[model samples]
Target: MNVDLDTAKEGLAVLQQYGGQAAAAAGSLLAGLASPFQLFEGGWGLNLLFFGVLGLLAYSLVVLAPRQ
Candidate 1:
């Protein structure tokens, strides 16, 4: 059995569509992971304290550390 050029082109187009969908799904997953605040929103006080500590740590790293 032999395949022609049109069949090969259609196969390539299908592969490209799947690749694009996979990329979109990956982006959505990363967006969900990257937000610390939105993940713990139900407990307001705890969320505030958690983010405050994160901010403090970031500030300490950026501001108080000696430049190398």
Candidate 2:
């Protein structure tokens, strides 16, 4: 069996579309993970403190630490 140029082009286009969608989804997930305040909204009290601590921990663990 043999494939033509048009079929290969169409396949590539489809792959590109899927790749774009996956990238977009990954970006959204990262954005959501970047903010913990939104997920645990509290009215300027212990809830805010809790979220702040969580955010700090996440930053220190992920950003401050060196990865191999």
Highest lDDT model number: 1
RMSD of 2: 10.3
Question: What lDDT would each prediction earn against the true structure?
Answer: 0.84, 0.83
Which pairs, if any, clash in model 2? none
> Model 1, 1-68: lDDT tens per residue?
79999999999999999999999999999867765546475566776788899999999899888674
Output the worst ten-in-a-row residue range by lDDT, candidate 2. Answer: 35-44
Candidate 1 weakest lDDT stretch, 10 residues: 34-43
RMSD to the true structure for each prediction, in A, is: 7.2, 10.3
Candidate 1: C-alpha RMSD to true structure equals 7.2
- Using all chains and alpha carbons, the TM-scores for the candidates as numbered come to 0.51, 0.51
Q: Report the C-alpha lDDT of model 2 over 1-68, residue by residue, as the tens digit.
A: 79999999999999999999999999999878866645455454766787789899999899888663
